[model samples]
Target: MTNELIQAQFGPRAMDYVRSSVYARGESLGALLARLQRDPIRLALDIATGGGHTALVLSPLAKRVVASDITGPMLRVARDWLAENGAENGLFCQHDAGLMPFPEGTFDVVTCRLAPHHFADVGAFLHSCVRVVRRGGCVAVIDNVTPPEPLAVRFINAFERLRDRSHNFEHSLPDWEAFFSTAGLRIEHRQQFRTPIDFGAYCDRMSVPERTRTRLRVMLLQAPAAARAALNPREVDGRMTFDLGELLIVGRRAAR
Candidate 1:
């Protein structure tokens, strides 16, 4: 049921992600590229490669890149987009993030960007990443994160689910660090950035129902002071805008 909801929500909107300015252009991408330039990447795996944006970015840096997604339609759209962009080193695979089909030590680098919130078991996903990457290989993750406050976390996740049922939960920075430690990956780099989201475009991306959209707006407007302060919702030129907290973390698999 969870997989079905994810596919249903993302299949038709694959192109939107392919063209999304926020996803395609970000300081996180620049930072990832800088790191890649410093180290050599022979083979890479991109988990849940929506629209293949990350794969496209990695194609030139790595000898080969496998863009894996659980949704067939999403993978198809991503493959087409990659081909259209003349990216020859990218291969699309249909597989779940929690349970990848690749053998152990199959990749030099593994990346999941802007998609971990949809994962049902982020711990399992991290484990899979550690298992597939060779010793001392890198795993880069970028996703939206929640504040540590319980009220803020609850309100933000609730609002997100209202907009997109596929959303699971956004993990906090501490949660990510703990997961990495448990998975036996050493944290090499970490950074946070504010990503501005246009509320109208956000709702439209998921094809949210009008009633739900109305409710979301009301929730944002009537949220408690803490929630409002955490989210910082506001109106800009007749459109609602808000900033989402995003984290970029790079961890390396243990050598021993």
Candidate 2:
């Protein structure tokens, strides 16, 4: 996907991310804090920080935290949000995930939460994450992942793309492992969560057209066995709901 498209898709809807419960308070965010509590984080970077939640959370832990996003409007929103939260050390930057301008070993920790799936070249983004972090520092990512089955992968990706034009491929666990390894980061921590997504709210978050919403509902209700197995689609209290597989993986740069 082009950077222009990504900016256009997310800039105007930036506030929606701030209001999103999934982004503002997710299990993965808690997991991140728990895992990094004991580590020393002097300078941290939060890439693709849509609403600045991760960066804000990292503020009290790291001596300084930089919230970076490709969308100018997103950065502005995040900057204001972080300031409102009294994150005195929080900083803002506008940059592409795949092409960070920071020097090598510039940060003690790097984080990307629920945003890598939109990256055009996930490997390049991971490499940039690894490159910017100091030796022995960790790069953490939390994002939706697809099932290993090829059919399910295709179906889920199609389902996502139907809602948002900027939607990109959500890779499988194995693909992420390979990408991390190839980027010179060694696996340190890994966890998965069955993230519940309300079908209606999900569509509304992207402002999906009414006709497209109908198609999405049909896609979920009539998904293939593999897709259903992966998503765990079902109805709850007259509302359609499903689980999206989210992986929180942490990889550390080799200390050599």
**Per-candidate TM-score against the hidden true structure:** 0.96, 0.98
Winner by lDDT: 2
| lDDT (10s digit) by residue, model 1, range 157-245 | 98888888899999889999999999999999999888888998988898888999899989988987777876788988988998888
Residue 16 alpha-carbon offset, candidate 1, angstroms: 1.8
Error at 65, model 2, angstroms: 0.2
lDDT of 1 at 136: 85
The lDDT values for all models are 0.89, 0.91
Q: What RMSD value applies to candidate 1?
A: 1.3
Q: What are the per-residue Cα lDDT tens digits for candidate 2 across 149-183?
A: 99999999999998988988998999999999999
**Which pairs clash (backbone N, Cα, C closer than 3 Å) in model 1?**
none
Among all candidates shown, the one with the greatest TM-score: 2
What are the runs in model 2 whose C-alpha is more than 4 Å off? none
